[model samples]
Each structure stands twice: as C-alpha cells, then as structure tokens.
Target: MGTVGITGDDGEFHLISMWVAPEARGTGVADLLLHAVLEHAGVGGGRIRLEVTEGNIAAERLYLRHGFRRTGVCGTVGGDRPEFEMVLDL
Candidate 1:
C-alpha cells in the first residue's frame, strides 16, 4: 500500500510506491495492486509511470508484462542507486 498520484508536470499519474509482505510475495498481490492503480479513476487508458531499481528484475518484469515499456533512466545516473522509468498507456 502507498500514495498514488500524478506528479508529472504533464499530469500523468505515477506509481509512487508499492510493497508486498514477505508472505505475499509470489502470490500475485503485486499484480493486483498494480492493476488497481492503473485502472483507477482517470488512469485507465491513460498514461502512467513508475520506476524500478536497476537490479530488481521481478518488478521490472511485472511492469513490462502489464504493457509498460521502458521510457528512460530515472533518478541520479551513475550512482550506486539507479532506477529505470517505465510507462504504460492503457
């Protein structure tokens, strides 16, 4: 659970944060949460964005499977922490 919003200057809703309990991992909770936000008011069929850690393959794959394509590099580049932006137009 987390705050969901459209922080983009263009008003595109961004998926800020999402977390699933350890016991819920691999049980499809992440999928349901993602889909819920994507399907939220004024979000469905519209542009939405998110970022995932560079090495978090599971999350990257999950977003990709939901039709989100890589947009570009997110946050600080060449730093110890890096994330990639992904977007979906439902």
Candidate 2:
C-alpha cells in the first residue's frame, strides 16, 4: 500500500519518492515504508533528504515526526506546485 526509495551515493541520500495509497492512509503503511527507507539510509552516517509538497500537512507531519527538519530550500513541481526540502540526519 505504500513505498519509498532513496538515491545518491557516499552516505548522502535523497528520498526519491514516497507514496501511500489513499485507502491505506492512517493504516501504518506509510510508517512502514518510511522505516524501510530510513533503515537503508542509516547504513551511512550522513543525511536523508526529501522534497515535500507545500500544504501537504499530513506528509509534513510524518516527516517532522520522523525527525526531519526543513532546510529552508524550496522549489516547484511541474512548474507550479510549491515544494520544500527537509532533512533527517542519520
């Protein structure tokens, strides 16, 4: 119901993508997927980063609860949707 992946090398990792089916929200699927990604990234003592869409409070809260902090970096998705970067030191 959910999945997440990482990219990058030499310890620095980026959460390339994460998604949980709408029907699976609040069912622990997202947590499981995030845990798996963190486990993989924790092999390196660097940091894991990801861009979350602005206004997606649920996702933002999930990352926050997982210890991710906003990095003050911002961007856009598809040339319109706003997004910001967050990081979790592993």
Candidate 3:
C-alpha cells in the first residue's frame, strides 16, 4: 500500500510525505494515492502544491502527468538535498 498527505493553507493545498512501499511500487499505487488527494482537493479551491527533490524524475514526472507545473521555487531538504516546488491548479 501507499500513503499521501495534504494540508490546506490560505487558498491552496499542500501535498506532503507521499510514499509507496518498495514492494508495492509500479502497481499504480502512486496514481491511486494521487487520485485520492486530488479528489479531496476538489473541495478546497482545487489548487494543490508539492515539493520534489531535485533529480527525482519519477516523482517529477508523476506530478507533471497530473498537470502540475514547477513554480521556480527552490530549496533544500536535510540541508543538502535539493528540492523544488510544483503546483497543480485544478
């Protein structure tokens, strides 16, 4: 199974802490998780935001496929892992 979380602030939702167990990956779990989040976001102004680590092509592609675009914002996790923000405006 997989899990994803979302929080609302201002007029947008922020996606955080998404994960799929290694053994359950590649089985559409990610898509399901994202779908659930998107469905929940429908009641919250239809905007969702998330951050992905730099070089995480799979995650980035997933977000992109779901209509998320980069916001040009950059930051780091753990003081070294580069990350950037993406937003989906439903």
Candidate 4:
C-alpha cells in the first residue's frame, strides 16, 4: 500500500509511504504501484520527492531505479537513524 501526499506550497508531490506486504514482495506488486504513482506525477508536472530510511539499500535501489537522484539532504528522521531525500523531476 502507499499514499501520495498533496502538493505542498512549493508544488512538490511527496510520495509519503509505499510498501508491499511481505507475502506480496517481489511479485511485481510494488512495481505496478510505483508505476502508477510516477505516471501520475509525470503527467501532472513539477517534481516528485520521497524519503527513505537509512540503511534501506533495497528501498534506495528501488527509488534510484525509478530515476530519483539522491540529494545532499540527509538528516536524522524521528530522532533516529538518518534518512535521505530523493527527487525525480517530472
């Protein structure tokens, strides 16, 4: 499951949360879901952004494979380990 947060004042679409159920992972569910989100974002214009928890190499690779580039905006999330902001321009 996933959610696309509304465009902020700056018009950026934040892909808030995206995940596949454990039993559904690697069955192409995530790919279809992410495809829909990115397609919508691309059609709408502007940029799409998301944050991935630190040490999540699999998730990071998934985002990178979708064309999101890692920015220098790294910081602790929820007062815990780091998170990185990634973006894809539509």
Against the unseen true structure, what C-alpha lDDT does each candidate score? 0.74, 0.92, 0.90, 0.78
Q: Write candidate 1's Cα lDDT for 1-90 as tens digits.
A: 332344443446778778888777898888888777766724435688888888899989888888889987578455768878998876
RMSD (CA, Å), each prediction: 3.2, 0.8, 1.2, 2.2
Give one digit per residue, the lDDT tens place, for model 2 in 1-90. 877878987889999899899999999899889998888888867899999999999999999989999999999999999999999998
Distance from true position, residue 85, model 2, in Å? 0.3
Candidate structures ordered by TM-score, highest first: 2, 3, 4, 1
Clashing pairs in 3: none
Number of the predicted model whose TM-score against the real structure is largest = 2
lDDT of 2: 0.92
Clash pairs, candidate 1, are 45-90
Residue 17 lDDT in candidate 4: 81
**In angstroms, how far off is 75's CA in candidate 3?**
0.5
Q: Model 4: per-residue lDDT, tens digit, 1-90? A: 443343543546888888787777777777777788877667657888888899998888888888899987988888988999999887
Clashing residue pairs in all predictions, respectively, total: 1, 0, 0, 0
- Residue pairs in clash, model 2: none
lDDT of 4: 0.78
> Candidate 4: which pairs clash?
none
Residue 81, candidate 4: Cα error in Å is: 1.5
**lDDT comparison, 1 vs 2, better candidate:** 2
- What candidate 4 gets wrong by more than 4 Å, as runs, is 1-11
Tens-digit lDDT track for model 3 on 60-90? Answer: 9888988999999999999999999999997
TM-score for each of the candidates: 0.78, 0.95, 0.93, 0.84
